[model samples]
Target: MLTQYHIEMNREALGEHFSERALQIITTANINQDRLAGQFGHDEYHFDNNAIDKGNRYINEQRGYILATLIGAGVSPSVAWSAFGRLLHSAQDFYAHSNYVTLWLDENNASSSALEIDPLTKSILLSPKLHTGKVYFPMDVVYFIKPLRSFALKLLPKDSHGWMNLDSPEQGFKFDYAIRAAVKRTKHEFELLQKLLTPEMLAKFVDK
Candidate 1:
């Protein structure tokens, strides 16, 4: 997902439940994941290159950290929210960066306008055909070299992130579906976090 969408979706998902400070911290961390060195190559961070098991492990690890930070004494609030944001980034990217959306459409025999289909309903995670866009040289590396970027993309396979991403509206109607999935996934991540948080901890974590 793009940085702006990450910010927008995270805020939309949790803005009402979290304080302004918590939202800021979370949003900052979410954006930083895209900026930080080596993160782009970390398939677990963006669910890129079909690192499914690694992605799941990363999410679980962050969940544990968020719980520990919230329930354990002396951990910084920023630490918890940071983990929260990182987790959301990967979860959100699952929709935008993977063939899951196409698979969903195929299963339902629907088009991009099929917004009525619940984004989270299908258990396509274990599908043998389910895979994310592969990231590779010249294709992703030359992204900053605008004129050559298109040429570079042509060299990438159909399964490459360059061809598969629904990061923006320009991608097509499927971008809308990705946006919806990402927003809902953000909320779902929060709810999953809540399961680990005590009532008192949850209250302390979110704004009243």
Candidate 2:
């Protein structure tokens, strides 16, 4: 997803539950992921290129880091937020990069108006065919260059990221669903963290 939406959606999801300082910490960490060198080529970073297992592994690794940091002595809120933000980035990207929304719409025969509803069922999310767009090169490269983007689209495969992304409203009608799902997932992540961390650990982590 786009950087602005990443920040906006995460804030919407976590604002009421976390202090402003804590929110900023995670937001900064989230944005930094995009700034990493060769980030676009890293399938697991954005859950792109049909890298489901890699993305899942990346998320679990971050979650493990957050758990260890929080549960052990000398808890570091910054370290925990950094890992949390990285995990959230991958989770959010699943909606934008994958066919999950399309699968939901197909199964429900739903339109964009139903975008606010939760799109994931156990079956839909875990479908064997559930897959994300492949990151085709040169075409993918040109697509990022505004002047060449339209031209690139003609060459990009229908199953490629350039064609399938729901990063913004301009991409397609499913942008709303992507935003909603990402926000919901962000909150869900926080809830899971709440469950895992002791009340004291949670308080410190969130600056409560």
Candidate 3:
């Protein structure tokens, strides 16, 4: 149930609730990535699907999972506005810092991103405050997720947290191994999400 018009959600409130919600979804999905991947194309839970387009196949599933999790958690339909806001803020920043990513998108019109830190994932890794630029064989969508792709594209590549370029096989395998780690890790921009939730959204999501 949505609150009356008198109710309001400030950014801080939204961030907290959103963080909680994101964590909830990430956790639930991590437990079931293999089953979910079967729905997509029989490929188990991989962060990147070589068979499908990068931003299209992978991020779409992540977004779908996030949305369904919210609904299952009883998020009021009204919360979508706040979620979109978070997506825009997080994805744009990641892209701006990844220069090689931008050039790849420009060259090929599409790109593939893997959880493993191959040349592909390394090119788009959102670098820590540094000025290095990166480029790939052909410009690709994974390179420019935000302006070029759907808002959900911001939250995907859920494999291998910390940096997009995960250094080892173990690290890559565990990329977003659990949702709480993904949502509550305190490093990624999901940190900026708002947590303010109405009594209704709160009651609904209390399970996690």
The lDDT of each candidate is: 0.82, 0.85, 0.32
Q: What does the lDDT read for residue 127 in candidate 3?
A: 35
Provide the lowest-lDDT 10-residue window in model 1: 111-120
Candidate that beats the other on TM-score, 1 or 2, i.e. the better one = 2
The residue-by-residue lDDT of candidate 1 on 1-208, one tens digit each, is 8899999998889999999999999888888878757455688988888887898899999988888888888777788888988888888888999987888888776754644545575478778888898887766777547688688777888888888888888789888888888888788888876887889888867856
Which lDDT tens digits does candidate 3 get at residues 1-208? 0111001212232344445654444333333332433325432133222222332244444445435646564555334433333332222222222233334443443433322123234433433431222222123224344354333334344321223422123333323222212222222333222244345544444322
lDDT of residue 171 for candidate 1: 84
**Stronger candidate by TM-score (2 vs 3):** 2
Best by TM-score: 2
* lDDT by residue (tens digit), candidate 2, 1-208: 8899999988898888878888898888887777857276678988888899999899989999988888788766889888888899989999999988888777775854544547447888789879898888778878989899999999998999999999889986788888888888888888888898888888878887
Q: Which parts of model 3 are misplaced by more than 4 Å?
A: 1-28, 34-40, 47-56, 68-208
User: What's every prediction's RMSD, in angstroms?
Assistant: 1.7, 1.6, 15.7
Q: Which stretches of candidate 1 lie over 4 Å from their true place?
A: 112-114
How far off is model 2, as Cα RMSD?
1.6
- Those runs of model 2 whose alpha carbons end farther than 4 Å from true positions after fitting are 36-41, 112-116
Candidate 1: lDDT over CA atoms?
0.82
